[model samples]
Target: MENNIASTDNDQRVRGYCAYDWGKSAFETSVTTAIFPAWFAYLFMEANGISMKVLGSEWTADAMFSAAVMIGALFVAICAPSLGVIADRRMIKMWWLRVLTILGSVSCILLALSPYLGVSVGWIWAMIMFMAANVGLNGAGVFYNALLPHMGDESEMDAISNKAFASGYLGGGLLLLVHLLMVTFIVDESGSVQSWVIPFAMASSGIWWLGFAQMTFKMVPEPHIENEMEPMGLIASTKMALGEVKKTLMGIKEFRTLFIYMIAYFCFIDGINSVTALSGVFGIVVLGLTVSGLIATILIIQFVAAPAAIGFTKLAEKWGTKKALQFSLVCWCFVIVGALSFAPLELENHDEYDIQYTWDEGNNTYVATAREGVNNIAALPDDGEQQWALEYEDILPVAENEDYDGGYAVKWAYEKDGTPTQVAVSLNATSLAALEGTMDESRFSYSISGGEFANSTGLGVEHPTSLGDGKLDFIPKTARSLVWEPLGLSVFFQFLLLGVFGGALLGGSQGLARSMFGQMVPETRSAEFFGFFGFFGKVAALLGPLIYSLMTVWFDSRVGIFAISLLIVAGAIILRNVDVEDGIAVAKAEDERNRASA
Candidate 1:
């Protein structure tokens, strides 16, 4: 409302620009990208080894994660508007920001304790912590976003917003890389008790944010708006905020495009959020991949996504935001297709496979003795009822088997009820080594009961495009074959670029949304308009995740990719109609009239 952000002739006013987009980088790294989603899956998925049919039947991991997100966001929707109004009325926005920041940081730190609880109770505790962190993050963002209009006018908005987003990309990518290294190499052990990496990283992020926040608090003085004399209580203020929102919607005619854009953003964002959350679970639980595979894949995503976001930003600017968004959507479609082509399905005759293993007679444990070729059976002592011991350090029970095959059958198994139940399967020792690189430590021990042989087939896609046909591909491979290929070093640079683009576009849109509202709406009720922003953004968070979940549940991991593509497409389409100049003009006039009345 003031000329605090007025441009100078030099255009080098970087003093108060500290409030630029860098602050939100912590939110992206700590809350959105790193901790919550992975933790949720580690805590929640049904780990007792249910039937494959049942695993496919229940809510897909994606859907369940999204549903949790939606439930959490509902609280945000109900409170955001009221909080916005109160913040404005009190003219002490810093106080609210401090409170939210503390709440969010504490919750994130607490989530590290989730792994200690049993599966049933662990999931609930983690979800509650996640919800609290999400609410705090969202609440803080609403206020932070609102400050954009105070930092720059329409002319400088593109530059400031873009820079802030770029900064966020850099911050998020760097932190993720560090965390990945910590989890992969530094953490020498892992168990049900706790994971030192996640909580420590989250706490570190909180410390970083609180430290940086001081710069803005010191430099940016509060706006000089006259306080609303009416001293309404919290309940009364909430009712008033709702009334104002209704009035704003009905009274403002040209706001149709803005509202529509919000709806579109909600739809697409939810899908993106949900898919990201489910990826780890799909890899570990559904594909039966090792923990290392899961970590490596996520690291790939974090690094790859960074540059992809940046490149898309430039593309959006060149072809217009809509075209750029559509391009991202296209990429998403291809990824989905690729994922479906690699869908993991249980093989019939899976129990029958020829594999050779060597047993340590001294310890009664099995070791990877050798593998000859495809369909090779191993020699085992023909003791049918021998109770072979099966062990794998902790938790996930190892199966026992008195049988052996020359092919790559149960990579590691023991006997259960005098029968061999497949515990783990691999193609080769190299594959096992790659997987083992990510875990804390693992031991392989099996008892030799007798020799048994069986043949198994996998339902692999016939072609990349032919996902619907129920087909099987017989290949001499191991369980590691099911894991996605690790993207090479090139992906890291590409991710950096993408991160820049996405950060700029997303940050710019967020800032632009704030600017338009500020410039068009009545100044006396600026808080009211902001409430709408809070409502829309929070709703988008809820809806995006929910849709992603549903799609993954109905189809497979590929469905998540399709949903993400759809969201990018929709966001681009909606952004096309956003005009910042007109909205500002209207808001200025409204403020002028209000001053006259006063």
Candidate 2:
């Protein structure tokens, strides 16, 4: 009966643990990846008009977002070790987890107020709230990950860890899909989406996170502390925690392979995480994709990643965990390289036509008058072949003219191959005269469109080729033309395709990496060691974004992106040297020693 009861409890605990991932993933997907970044970008654009002055330097919305994430990560890196030690010494892991979850959820909910805060300070408030929420999310993750060793044995670690990641993807993806639908359908009178809809989506993510975490609170029991220290005041406990951390640092050679793995993890995970965090912002700023497009792409990643994570467990079993992980890292390198070359095509053709205007002295306004017989005309150099064309909207005059109707002729001039080919769309003289008459009355608006002209000119607008006029301006422009444009695919399709490839590797890499670490960490000191694990990860997280931000500010975002690829490569090379069997042996021996001493 006792054995059955214990089995049931373990099963419940595993489910509960996975539930926490499901809960928190809402925050990651809806708030971090999908909605908040785009909403913040919109707010920043509305307030500061594309760039903001920071420290007397003009910074783009993406750079500021990266900086905010860097600050939060740096703060958590400094605190994770001591916090980890305290949780190890006391029965405080669950309590700390709860506290951090509340902090994160509340901060996320409060973000809805950003729209009401006035444009001048709305983005500023949003950034501060986002930073606080990130601190909570990252801080909670330290304690959350520490529970892995206690939940299952080494043999089951990969399955259990990957299952949690899969659960997270499903939970996060579902919510993001719902939010995407909401944003897509909710439009204002102008057919543009209402800005407030996104902020509401952000709040919903926090609510989802907090609401689902109750399962974890109810089912996962706080682990018992072995060799428990006597209760002390906060300051005393902090000092003791610091001393314990120092001892572990000094004894690092005892687990040399583990430490070596941590160093490699620190390097590579930084690159992985930075790519994940900045992808939405990158799309908005660089690719010029809409929020809906970014959300759709992230949703694709989430659904693909959930199943991919489970598939990786099988791969880990057949190929060994470390080898499987290395494969994913190689895939990541390719993804990043592909991202650096992702130049989006400008499909929309909206050119400013040179329309001649005369100042109307009679009404104190500018009158757009016809250069020839037509009031508004677009003239292109026509070749002998009927390749070039002009398209414009049907015109309507405020006043009726008997001699003119809203019809235009396609008159094209300039000959090729000794052929005078002239096609022009024109308005009748009376309507043209009326259009000029109503120019001062604010009663007319005009628009133009043409696809053949764009095709003939080969003038699709591309993203800026130079990474700004800076130190890296000398870097050759490789991503000037859209890579997939020749195939007649939208840039969003490219992002969707990339997301699938990235998604397949995302959860697999992280899940297997964490599982491998859990297998090598002594269960007796799980929290303490996992704290150091979080410390390394959080600290590593700091460097990637900081480097990316600095590179972006000093040179350009492209250089920043290129710089991240180098970290992943360097880390992968170092990871090849770590001996997994030796690390596992040391972990088992340490656990045995601890049990004997106790």
Find the candidate with the highest lDDT and give its number.
2
Over 346-446, each residue of candidate 1 has an lDDT whose tens digit, in order, gives 22222221233333345444333221112112222222111121122121223223333221222333332223333223234454334334232211211
| lDDT, candidate 2, 355-440, per-residue tens | 23333345543333221212222111232211112212222211112222122124322232222222233444454444444334
- In model 1, which regions exceed 4 Å deviation? 1-24, 27-32, 36-68, 110-127, 189-198, 227-230, 252-254, 271-527, 548-560, 563-581
Q: What TM-score goes with each of the models?
A: 0.63, 0.75
Worst 10 residues of 2 by lDDT: 452-461
